[model samples]
Structures are given as C-alpha cells and as structure tokens.
Target: MLSICARHCVLWSIGRCANGCRTRTSHSSPRFPKSRSPTALPPMLKPSVRSAHSREYLGTWGISNGAQPGLFTGTCEGPRCDASGPEKGYTPHARVQQGFLRLLVRAQSALVQRSHHKRRNCAISGARFKRAREVVMASYIKRTIRLNPSQARTLSGFANRRGLSEYALLLKVIDAGFLALLHGTDRETDLAEMASVIGSISERLAERGTSREEASAAEKQIAALDTREAKSHADHKSLRADWRATAEAKGFGEAAQARAIAEAKERARAGELAASPEILAARAVAWAAAKLSERQAVFPASTLAREAGDYAFGRLSHNAISAAIAEAGERGALVPRAYLDRRGAESAGFTTPEAIATEQAMLRLEAAGRGVSVPLASSLAAARTVERAARQSARAGFAWTDDQKRATSALLTSRDRVAAVQGYAGTAKTTTVLATYAREAAKSGLTVTALAPTASAATVLGEALGLRGDTVARHLVSPEAKGLGKGAVWIVDEASMLSARDMAALMASADKAGARLVLVGDVRQLGSVGAGAAFAQLQQAGMATAKLANVVRQTNADTREAVMASIEGHAGKALAALERGGGDVIEGASRDARLATMAQRYVALSPTERVRTLVIEPSRDGRDTLTAMIRQQLVQRGELSSAAVRFEALEAKGLTRAETRQAASYAIGDVVRFARDYADKGVTRGSAYRVERIDPDKAAVALKAADGSSVDWRLRQWGAGKVEVFEC
Candidate 1:
C-alpha cells in the first residue's frame, strides 16, 4: 500500500516525505499556489516560483491522491506542463462518477480498518470495537473461511470481474487484516432458518390437517425462499452484468476489458509511467495465465506495463509468444521477469511482479495438495426411504398434522381398526393419505396392500412407502402373505388410475387375503384407469365419504403448481408464468463455455455439438410441428440418439389427471422417445420413452420398457415434437 501510494504521488511537485529523500528547486519549474483552505489560493499567489520568492507550501494543501489535487504552478516540460483542460474538476458526468468511486474507496477502507482493529483488539471502549463478544459470537469470518457453496459463488464473481483468480480473492480475504465484518449475520440467518421451518410446518398443518401430501410439499417451499434473497445478491444485478459479459458487444477487439482496466489502474498509481521492464513482465505473465484457462479472458490492447518496459511487450500480439514466461524457476511475465533480471543486474529495491506472482502460485499449489469428494442425488426421496427400511413414521407418532392425528386417533385409535383415508389438493392427496395409513398400519404386524390405479401412480407413492417402487409389482400378490395369521389392510393409491382389470384383480387379492379395503384418490384430479375408476364410483354408491379441503403446497411454486394444475388442467399456464432470461444468448459466448456449463447441468453434451434453438412469437397454433422439427433436427444433427425415441401415452404408462388435463392437451395420436437422466447427469442409453400426451408446460410420455414400466419425463427435455404454427 505504501509503495502504491508513493508511486501515485511521485510525479507531483509536493511529493510525500520519505527517508532522506531530497529535491532541489529547479528555476524553470512552474508553480501553482497552495491553499490553507481548499478553495482559497495562497495570499501571495504567483504565476511561477521565482528563486527570490520561493517557499515550499507542503502543509497548505489537502493532498488527495485522486487526480486533480489543486493546481501546481511550475514551469515544467512534457506531461506535467502539457496543455490540459481549463479547470481541474471533472466534467459534469465524471464529477458524480468520481465522487461515487471516492465514497466507495473510503467505505472499503473503513471496512478493512474495522477488521484490522478487531484483529488487533484495538481499544475495548472504541465504539466499533465495543461489545466484541455479542458482535462476533457467530463470527462471519470463520464461516466465510469454511468455503460454503454460497460464499464460493460470491468470491468467484468478484475475482472474475477483476480478472484475478478466485483462489487469489480467497487468499486476500483470509489475510488476517481484512475480516472485520463478521457480526450478527450468521446468528440472524440461523434464527430465520429455524423460524422458517416452524412457520412452514404450522401453516401446512393449519391448511391441511392429516393430509400427508401437503406436509411433504410445505418442506420444499420453506427452503426456496430461505435462499432466494441471498442468491440474488450473489448473482449480481443485470445492470452491471453487461460490462462483465465476455462477448462482442463489450466493444473491444484484442485483449480483455478487465486487463485493460487493470493496466489503467496501474498507470494511475505509477505517475511517471512504468520505468522498468519488470512492470511489463507482470502484464506478460498475467496474459499467459489467461491463455492457459479457457475460462479466463484475454486482455485486449497494448498495455502501459508492457509498452514502458521491453520489446517483449509488443511481441505479445504475435501468435507464438505466450503472454508470460518462466524465469528463475518461477512463472513470470516478460515485464516482471525483465524487472527481476534488471534488479539482479542493478540492485534496485523495486518489487517485481514475479515475486508477487510466486506468492500467489504457492498458495494455489498448497490448496491443490489437499483433496475432497461428495456423492450424487438421483431420486433422493426413494434412496432415503430405502435407507430407512421403508419406515415413514417419525419417532414421535409420525409428526402428523393435528387433523391427521385426530383422524388417526378417532378412526385408527385401535391398532387393528380399519380406516379409509382420503384427500385431494396441494399434493397427490389420495396417494399421500393412503401411504400415511399404510405406514401406521405396517407397525401392527399386519400387511397393508396399497393399490395404485396405474404403474406410474404406484411409482410415485413407492417413493415414500418403500415398495419395489413399481406399480405392476405393487399390486401382484406377494408369496410371503399367502397365509398370514394376521389379516392385511388394503390401500388404493391413485386408485383413479387403475385399469378395470388391475382394479378387479386388486380387489380379488384384497378380499381373498382378508384385507380391509381403503380406496383413495381425487376423481377431480383424474379418473382411474379402465375399470379401476370403480373405486371413485364407490363414492357415488356411498360406502363412506371423506372429502379433504385446505391446501399444503411445496415452497417451490413450480412443483406445487405441477401437482395442483394437473388436477385443474392448467399446470402449463402456471409454469409458463415464471420469468426466464439469463442464459447463453449473446453471440461470441465461447461454445466451449456454454458446453462446460451444460456439463454441470444436463451433463451428456459436448461443446462442439451444434446446438438447436428456435425463436418464435407467442401464439396458440402450430407448436407441434415446431417441436417435431426440433426433434428431427436433433436427430438430423445428431444431438439426440434415435434409438431412445418412443411413442407412448400416459394411459399406456398408467398416469391420471383431471378430464381437462388428461390430455395435457394430448394430440391423442402423439408419440415420442424418452431418455433418462442419471442424477440429472448422463442421458441413459435405451431410456427413451414415448410422448403420449401434450399440454402447455410439457408432454406426458411413457418411458420405454426397461424391465417393465412407463416413465415420467420432464418438460425441459421436450425437443422436436412441437407444432410450428406462428403468427405474423
């Protein structure tokens, strides 16, 4: 810092005092009057400092290192004397801009100093340092040091903007002198987290008592809001984002904009311009580092650090010259390397870029020496259920909603007592209710047969109840229960989705097995498969009626809407309302960058593949053809494999929805191939399913039979099967 400050002030006449630094008054030098008050010039002002009336007025001026520090009236030549603008103040726009930067610099300084004070234990009574225990009980510095996913994101943005390594930013912050802002934030966040969890549970229960579906949804919603605000700040506002984007619109040709800004900053600090090759070498080294990482930007334009030092600087634009060079066993840019060489040759005390670069290198090397690893989540719900041995009950009476507990106590108080659970809304009501009943029933040493109308419905419920996670297998009689001493209870999950044959077979098995039958599902959500619709018909016949009201939806609006809209037939409209913009749209976005990004997401793609995209105005007709063209193109361009395509509908796969939604606007004759995403990663081979139905948000499809069952596909994967109708 001292060196940087010194360099900034060096070219000015009133230089900062240093150890034994000397200066002689040059007769021809121009003089500018100093002022005791900022706006008031010296009483004895002069056009030039004459030998007879010259006296240093060092203390008379307010020396802000920022440009335009008051006029220095000296008869100097070259830059100092070159004709400049009449007034030293900034132009109209600049005044505001400069003022803001000055304020920011001071703010950052204050933050830095505050941290410094905390570390040094500066005066206990000092206001900023007071009540240290409470101020830092949950130290931000310690937590930030842990490198959580969120903080890493923030650090990455900062470093990327400055054209520095993220590793460098981490080191800079951890520098003991910079960690003073660690007060109260962590504890406050923790309190919020707890409150959020409790409130979500309470709200869920109030809305839907004993409704198992609602409880599961409420948990996911509470978590999304918890991170949204934090994520916004971490993402950077779109305003300043344009300046940081790596593309043609940045309005530059040769090097990176960040690199240019860095060079300008270096020049501002080094008043007389770089006087040594070491400075130029630093730029070269910086350049080399960028070229090595496809992720890093190349600084465009000739740099001052290079221009002022060596011939190597100009050579950088040449094809073969690497931006940096290795010198003395350390990675160094030409400027720094030259500076280091000159230092050895001349014994100057100036710091070389290579020295600083080495320190940064060592830090990276040390971090890389350590290794760590983690796992993947592909249907974590099912995995978790399996891990718990299929138990859904909490240690304390299953953490049920009061209404559910009431129902459980009233109708199910006795261990072997039979109760037919029911509900619809906020979730897959029928399925959740039966699953909960099945869970409680499991502990009675009695088997519970939860029948689902369709294989898909069975698969959905299987996620929680610990079954084969398949429908066909779920309804078939298990040999283990052939002659059970204790009778089993029957549960029909998504009973509305069962076919006549499956439903009849299920009923036969339940009756023969002496199982008490509990049929559940939302007839409004969708009618049952084939004759399985018989269960909902039972309600019309009046066995026992239980209607569920009140909604318990997930924190994620999309998931909640998906469950709700399918029942109402508007899932697509709800989903399409979500705003989406940030993505790879601008040209010159390195294809590789886009591809690497996809690897993190739908990992099966490579950078060089020709990506297919379509632009269209909002319209209602001709979407199918467009979707098909896209799919055709994918196959034509070899983006998606052909063997993975299938043509099956929700019926073939056993999924049910409200009459209006059953089609999901299904063309009634649509077909498609399916693909499976592993841990949301690789697109598994032979995983293609057929698109059986279509709607605003997605197409419902039956995945190709692997062992034997239909698959549910995500809307995002929909490619070429779209209608192409457009408006002029």
Candidate 2:
C-alpha cells in the first residue's frame, strides 16, 4: 500500500521532474530531502472542511499542533515552485474565487511530492496540511443584492452620512433590525416613550430662559421665608424662657412638683377628685406651686386675653386657664407654665396626623392577616370536592415539611378560585408544588405543568416537577393551551416577577384553557423586569394568599433568623448576623469603586475552571463594571487572550428601545452562553455554544456544541426571545 500510494501521490505532485519518471521533490525550490526510495508517502487521511466543525477536527488529528503538512520533507514550496501534475487542471494562479477545495489541492500536491522524495520517508502531519491549505486558497462568497429604487436611495444616503460604503450601510441596517427583533420590546410603548422624550426635549428648550428667571424669584421668596421663620422661632424661645422663670419662682419647675401633678391625675382617674378638665388642671397647678409661692403668680383680667395667645399646646380655653390658676392659688403648689408647654410638645409628637394614619393602616394590616377572600362561583358540592383534594394533599405520601404541607393546603383550599402562595426564599415552595403535582398525577392523571415569566425559572420548576417547563408567553400564544381540560393544572413560579401586562396575558390564557392556576413566589424578592406590579396589586385587592414564613433552607439558626429578619425589613438585625458570620461590609467612596474592589477580591480567590464563585450585584451598572474588571483580570492572568476580549453587547432588560437597536448584534462564530436550562436536551443554563449560522430573515440561529456537533437552536431559545449574547 505504501509503495502504491507513494507512487500515486508523487505522480499528482506539481513541479517538473528532471528525470521525467513522475517522481517529484521540492529540490527545484527550497531545500528538499533527497529520495532514499521513491516509495515513502504521507498519510492518506482526507481533510473535511465542509462545515465549521470539520475544520476544527482536521486541525487536531495526528499532529496535535496546527502546523502545515510539509514536515515529511525538510522544505516547503509556494505556488511559484516548478511543480507540475497531470495536465495542471487547476492553475494555482486562477482569478476565480478560490474555495477550500482549491486550497486543499495545492497544499496536498506539495506535501505529497516532499513526502515521497524526503530522506525521512515519513507521512505528512494533518495539522500542517490544514494551515498550508488555508494560506493558499483563502475564499469568500461574493453575493450581489439588487435593491429597489427607494432602498438604493436610502442606502446611499445612510452610507454617505456615515462615511461608509453602501454595503457597510446595508450591513448596519440589518444588524440593527436583527437586534430589535432579538430584544422583544413592545413597539407601541417604545414609540410612546420616544414621543415623550421628544416632547421633553422641546419643552426644555422653550423653558431655558424662563427657568433661570423663575429660579431667581424662587430664591428671593425662600430667603424671605427664612427671615420670618427665624424671628418667629426667637419669639417662641423668649416666651418659653419667661414661662420657665415664673414656674421656678413659684417652685413648680421642681421634679417633685411634676410628680405630684401625675399622682393627682391618677387620683382623679380613681375618683378621688373632680375629673372635669378645669378641676384637674387646677388641682395639678395648685399641687405643683404649693411650696415656694404661698401666693400664685397672677395675671390681670385685662391682660388675660393677650397672655392666653402665648399658651402652648395650640390654644387653651380662657375659662380653663382661669380655673386652673384659681385651684393652684388655693392648693399652694407652684405649677409652672413651662411644664404645660413641655406637655404640649410631647402630645404633638405622639399625635401627629401622619402617625395617626399609620396606626390605622397597621390595624387594617392586622385585620387582613388571614387574607381577604373573593367569592367563588362554585357551589357547595363543588367546593367540597376541592376541600377533599386539599385534605388528600396533606395526607399524600410525599416528604413534606410542615410549611410545605401548609402551603399546598392553602393552594387547594383558597376561598377564591384565584389565589397566591407567598413563600419566602428557601421555604420549599417548589417542593410543595411538586408534591401536589405528583398527587394530582396519581389520582386523576392530570397534566401538572409549570410556567414562569423567564425560561430559566420555568426550567427549574419543570425539573422539580418532573415535567417540561416553558415560558408563559408560549402557553399564551397557543390556542390549544387555552382552557387546559379540568384535569390539567398549571403552576406558575416566580409569580412576583410578572408585569401587569404579562399577568393579564397569562390569565387570559388560563381562562381559555380552563386550567386551574396556582401562583407561587416571594414578593419581597425582585419584582417584574417590565412595568406595573400585578402581584402586589392583586395582594392589595383582597386576593386570597398564604404567606410562608419559615426559613427552611438556612441550617444555621443565626443565619436563618437573620434572613427572616431581613425579609421582614429588619436591616440592623441582618447586618449584625452577617458581621457575626465574619462577613465584612466594605464601603467605598463610590459604587463604581466598590464594584472594582469586589472584582479584585473575586480574582484573589484563585478560582479554577469548575470552582467558580458568583458575584450577585443589585444594579445593572454595578454588574457591568464588575464584569469589565473581571474580564480584564482574567486577561492579565492569561486565562483569556487579547483577541478573545470581545464585549457581549446584548439588548438585555432595562435598556431603552433606542439603545437596544443601537447595541451590537450577534454574528456567526460569536460565542454565547445559554441563560436558561433545557435539561432534556442536555443543555443546561450557563452552558457555552458558538453561533454557527444566523438567518435574519427567519429570525433563526444555529449553534455548534463544544464537542464539534451542530444543534438546530432557534431564536426562541436565545434568552427566551430577548437574546442574551455573552463572551465566553
């Protein structure tokens, strides 16, 4: 085989053989090993470059390094070599667009010649062959698109404006359109927002000069108000000082005198004295003034009206004041006017309008602890059926925690047909739902499905319930999904994350399917990414709800207590617990600096491929800053290459429509990470894949797996319609 193959390869080689025996060598060009025997040859394995994956495979065979296949010989020759083969079918100098095959042929011819004639008599390495071939026939497909008159005009205008060619302009337009579709934003809302922005800009321009003058006038008014306020406060202080002097002169400023007044109030309450306001005040004053002033400080009848205006605690009736003075004169306890003023201040603090309103609201919350119920249309008999199911769930053979059992019970026994089960983090809400699903499956063989506003959350729900999970949008669009038969039930997780619009759509779908829905989430966690709070509104509108309070996931009592406290809004407690656990709270001069510091700390952890840590950031800006810093650190550590430092410009949530359209779009060969898990397909969330092909017309995409295989991944799988592109 070696002899035959060597003869055949050598015959196919290019370059003239001085001996005219069909044997070839690179001796006419660079250095070539002298022929020991004209029977040695390179390996006959064919290189496959039909697809992107095939090119990668060829680069790794036999020769691990991606070197060209001229290693069998001591030299290599370019197309300029005096190499000749059977009739020279393809002239190496052809002006036609050279493709992979043309390049392959050129490389193979030179490699075969050197292999057959080389002194080593060794086979050519595959890695070297691929590189040599790439250097030869580098190819491209030239496609000419015919545009209509209007499109041509538009393209030319845009190109001229951008200082780019019409072709580049077209590419830009395509890229922008592709991103808009990938982001999945509401067109109407975007337009409305755009209009609002335009209006605001116009208004600001019109008001610029007027605003400066108005600001000046406002400053003058503020200064006047400050002056008046200062005078009024000084008068108040002087009045208080005078009242205190009178009280001290009468011995009423003593703590003992105040204590006596308190005792007298108690006695009056116990019926030891008259409980009338005048009598009570009189007794308090007389008891307080008794020691120093055998006579009480007196005000003239004519001056009483003027003096009463300075009285504290808003205004007191003249008759009441006169009666109090008379009693104080008789009791001989020096009651100071300053004491009355202090009492007024304390009363004002306690009975502010806002404080009273808050007290009323708290009362309402207490009353609504069991959750207000909406009347259901079901009859007693129908209700009893649900009640029985509820009982059975509690008795089911699932390993349910107390909280889980209660949560399931709440779902089954909700007074209103619509209800929510509010579970705190790590409270086994998912576990409870899965148990119910199993129970329903066993009794009536119902299709217990799970849906979420996001693909990732839905996937998690589906996994726990042993069913396929899908986004709520998918169920809403399919007519078949409407009115899930009576036996079917749908569980919606992360219910709090659904915007009002999404909630309405999901509800409409549920109504169509006639399937029962059980919403479960922790409201204290993140709300919807879009607009409006449907979950909170529903809870406020007297919707039936079961709030799961136990912190089931945290094993440490202190940590669990801290988590529960934080959820309940006890910031101090949460911080204390964290500090006890050796967690340090780092404060930076700015949020950006803090984020950078955090990135530095993460790098210091010395993470390996599988031992990575997660840095949870609350804001998008913080996340972006930390991400950039982390990328830079990785590059510095030699974990990433300079060429691989591509920023993943995605049209993710929280970006405006204009920004979304202007963001960078995905192209073939860009690496992406799956943001959601598709477990059945063995593609988990965070898994990496490369974009193989993109069809902007169809909004479709193809992905190449890590193992050099292709998967028909559609746009729907890309961040559940809002394609989350990332650099791996």
Candidate 3:
C-alpha cells in the first residue's frame, strides 16, 4: 500500500496522479485539473488507509511541521487521522488530502507576505506622498458656478469675439472686482454705482456736450444716500435704546449696558441729538475744544456760536447752552466748571493743564531759535536797528511826498519783527512803500529780495522796484534758494493772500536766515485764500501794521473816494462814490441784449481803441459768453480769423466728445493758448503755441513754442479740468 501511495504521490506532484489529475512531464509544473472524466481511475485505486508515501510528500510541502500538535498528520495509525482532524483516526488518503489543503493555505499566506514586503520597501516618503496627493487635488480644486442663462450666453459670445476662453473671461471679471475692492469700499455696490454714473455721463456727453452739471448731480446723489443712511441708523439706534432700557430693568450684563452707551453715541453722530440733552452738551464741549488755540483761546458764548455758523447758532437756545454747561461742568479737564458761568458763557476754553504747558514750552523754544517762526521777533532792539537802516536808505536815495515819507517812516520805525504796510488799492504801495523798502534795504548793504505769492504779483513788484522779484515759493521758501545773510530783507507783496501754513513756512525760513520780513497787503480787501486767516490772526495778535488810508494811484477824486469807501466796507457810501464818478448802473431786459449792445459799442470803436478796451464780467459763464461775442465781432472786423475754435472749459469729471472735437479741430500753423502753467517746460498759464502736427488716433497735438521748440501733448491732457486749449 505504501509503494502504491508513493507512486501515486509522485504522479500527482508531476500532474499525472491517477485519482483525478491529468499527467504531464516531470520538468513541467503541476496543476489541479477541473475535469476528471478522461483521467479518473475507478474506485479500486482509492485508498482507505496506509498512504505512507503521500504523508512523506506532504512533509516535503511543510505539512509535517504540525505533526506533533493536534493538527492534521498524514498517518492512518494516529487517532488524529479522522475526517474531523488528527484528533480522530482518518483514512491515509483523507489525511494526505488534509495535508495538501494545509500546504495550499501556507503557500497563499507566504505569497501575500512577499507582496506586502515589496509594497512596504517601495512606498513613498511623507513629503513626496503629500505632494502627489496635492497634485491630484489641485486638478479638481477649481470651482464650478452656474450663471443666469442669458448672462452665460452673452459672456460666451463676448469671450469668443475677443478670442478669449470662458475661464479667461472669468479671470478678467475677478481682476476688475479686486481693483474695486482695493480702495476698501464695498465691491459690488460701489462698482455698480460707478458704472451707472459713467454710463450716464457718457450718454450726457454724447447728447448735450460736457458740463459740470452731471458731476454735481452725481455728488448730490451720493450726499442723499449718506443722509438717508444716517437717518436709518438713527432710527435703528432709537429702537435699540428702547430694547436696551428694558434689558437694563431686567438683570442684564455689563456688555448690554456698554452696547447701549455705544448706540447712543452712534445716534449722536447721525445728527439725532435734538432730544438728547447729554449728546448736545457733549457736542458743544467738542466744538469748543477744537476751536481753542493760543492765538484766541478765550470763548464767550456769543463768539463761539458765531464761529459755529448761522445754522448751529440758530439751534443754540438758552436751554441748549444750559444743558452744555451742565454736562461740561462734570468734566473739569476737558470743559472746566470754573470756565463756565451761570449765563453759560465760557470765559476760558476747554483745555487741559498739560496742553497749556505744551504751548508755553513751544513759545519758549521759538524764542530760543529752536522753533522760530513768522511773527514778531524776540528782540525789540534788533527790529529797531533794521527799521533805522531802511529809513536811512530811503532818505539818502530818493525824494518823496509827505504821505510817502510818512508811510516810509512808519514802516522803518515799526517795533514788530513782522510789520505789515496795510494799504488799499491805488495807495501807491508798489511805487512808494515797497519800492522805498527795497531801495533802502539795498543801500544799507542788505540783500533785498522782493517776493509775492503769485507770478503776476511778483512781476508787477519787480518792474516797479527795478529789481527782479520772484514768487515766494521760488526765492524765500524754496529749498534750492541760497541761505540769506543776517541783514537780508524779504519784501513780501500780497502777504494777506498767503495761507497759515505758507505764512508759517515763510516765517520759519526768515528766522533761520536771521532776516527782517516786511509783509505788505491791504487787509480790508480779502483775507487769506486758504486757511487760518494768518494775516488777520497776526494783526489781531498785536503785530505792528502801517495803515495807508490815503489813495494816490487814482488821479480822479471821485474814483479815489469810491475806492476808499469800498475798502472801508461802507457799501452805501461806495455806491454813492461810484455814482459821483459818473459810473451808472446799467440794466437790460435780457443778458443777450446787454451782450449785443456791448458788442455793437465795442465794434464801433477804432481797431486801436478796441484793442485797448477790456470787458469784465461777474460770472465765469458770463465772461465766456462775452468773450465769444467779442471774438465774433473781432472776426467781422478782420482783427481775428474765422478759423479760430472756441474750446470750452473741461469739467472736473473727464473729457466729453465736444471737447475732443474742439481739440481735434486744430490744424497745422494754428495758434492756441495754454490755459495752465507747465513750469517744467517754462510755458506759463497763458503761453501761445503754434500747432505743427495733429494725430487724432493717438490724441496727439504737436505744437511749436515761441522759442521754436516743438513738443507733443495728448489732446486729453490739454483738456484736463485745470487746463484748456483755445485757438488764439
């Protein structure tokens, strides 16, 4: 039985087992066959027990490793050779079959282990694996959004026409959205509003020609929105207050109380403080604090109200003043109780001890040369020396009238470091006061530089003094100007027109050079154009000023009296004086009729007389109309060419089709006026240009200056709000 089993085992290993296996060569690997009809032997060859050789074959396959255990073994003599396992005795063939099944299980597990080891050894590192995962995720990261059907269709069409992909079009939209948000505004709403404004402006430009009306309308719209929103916020605050009162009545937290107070402040900011006594008082204190300064620090109730404007002053009743005083009295530092009286008048102003000390310290530093500025000098004796020198120079150089001598003597004898020659128009300030000062300073071995805020003023002064004068920005305050000697004198004309900051800078510059500054202007004409009312402030601060009430420029007595009355702010007297000068008020039924009559009168004059005549109008629009009429009349008289184009002033927003058309109409050899100064090119505000070339596509308008130099500028540039290019 063992011999037969061993042969059968050999046959099975080589794929030729007689039981059911098909035979193959020894060199060939063995495999179990599915069909056994052609290879199966009859049941006679089937062993019941005693298949020793098969057990040996099983051992070779590692089935013998479990022989000593309770597992299956290929021996019929063992009690474990039963069908259940080696626990019960089994047939030899059955035992061999169990060993073969175990061998197949072991082979499968080994194959799984080998494959797992290969996977572990060839696995990716953490970083490399993460990078690979990111690459895969990046391919799917793009978001897909649905657009409205019509919008999608239109966008697709536009993209196709522009040779751009749908994705590229989306990117373009995103870029525009980013720019709108860059200014820290609401992107969607702001962009939409701006687009609407632009569309309206463009349509208006196309239809009626460009004007400032559209820009004004846009500003009004924005203002209206702000007002509406403020009202809404105020309403919300009132509603919140009602809820907050109830919350506090119940046992609410500190946060709720804090929120209530914050909402109240917001309501005040929205101008909803009419019913709130606390907010009104707080507002008064804040307003007074802002207006307080060392120059004019005290505040009487009436004066404070006047500074607050007519609208606010009208709102301030006795009750309002009482409420403000009551609240301000609670805070001694900001609004001191000592400052407020029973009548609600604040004698001093809302200021702290620290602030007062700081101001005093600054004044001390200024006297010490650390913060020396434009005002009266620290030394009275030094100022007297400078004044004496000016007087001596004037006396030795030229003969003068009694009034001129008096004015010259007054300026020279002034004790204030910053002296003003307060003279009205036609007072011979340029010829008498300024000229004498310049000549006197020069004779005293002092460098006298005449300066004015504007080029025209400087030129007038320069021509009158026979010494070239420059704008204050160019000569005194300019960084490029050489340092002045100790005895240098700056004769500043039109000194009243300077803003506070410019005045301060001028003073600081003068102080640095240890120079004497003589400010010359008519204070009664107009105050500073910008801010702080420097001339007025200094005059009020007790600076020495020479008053020149006598008029010398106007030869006619009636004209002189009219000028004097106007300068003194006597309206009725000024009108009477004008009537005395044979100046009558003219009235016409319409502006057009008045313009027509004026044109006829101008045309009736001889060419020489007409050239000397000047027409002045109160309004810019009126001036433009009169200019057009005068130009048309000049053309009729052959004084001007018909080819001259009337270029309208550009509005603040942007250029319109009408302006572009006017600019493009200029041709070669046409002369045009530069409406603004281009200082870098030495072209003044009213410089003339002769057009040499024109390119409409590039918006280029090439011009040759009077000096024969040529430069090209864009038509749009020439039509900026600050500039206008009119055919000359």
What is the descending lDDT order?
Answer: 3, 2, 1
**Stretches of candidate 1 exceeding 4 Å from the true structure:** 1-411, 414-419, 425-436, 469-482, 499-505, 556-728
Model 2 scores a TM of 0.36
Query: Going through the candidates in order, what is the number of backbone clashes in each?
Result: 67, 29, 10
- Which residue window of length 10 is worst by lDDT in model 2? 148-157
* lDDT digits (tens) for residues 1-728 of candidate 2: 01113332221233322122222221111122344311222122122112222111111111112333321111113332233422221111111111222223333345545555443222322111111211211111112112211111111113333354322233334333322222222343533232232233224434544321222222222222232211111233334565456555555576757578657655644663335666555543332222111111222332332333232122346667666655443554322232112123321101122222333443343234343332222355334544554566557743446565555555554544355788888887776544563455435556777888899999998898877888888877765576455556677889988866567666656555555666788777887765445676667766667777776687787788789888887889988887787777788998878888988888778667327667889877678788889889988998878676455564333332221122124566666566577765556577667778876433356788788867655442234333355433
Identify the superior model by lDDT, candidate 1 or candidate 3: 3
Q: What is the lDDT, from 0 to 100, of the residue 434 in candidate 3?
A: 70
Instruction: Show model 3 residue runs off by greater than 4 Å.
Output: 1-401, 413-416, 480-482, 570-576, 645-728
Please, what is the whole-model Cα lDDT of each candidate in the order they appear? 0.36, 0.47, 0.49
Positional deviation of residue 586's Cα in model 2 after best superposition, in angstroms: 2.4
Tens digits of per-residue lDDT, candidate 1, 448-532, equal 5545656666666666567544453444657633554345665566665654445445545544555555555667666533322
TM-score versus the correct structure, for each prediction:
0.26, 0.36, 0.40
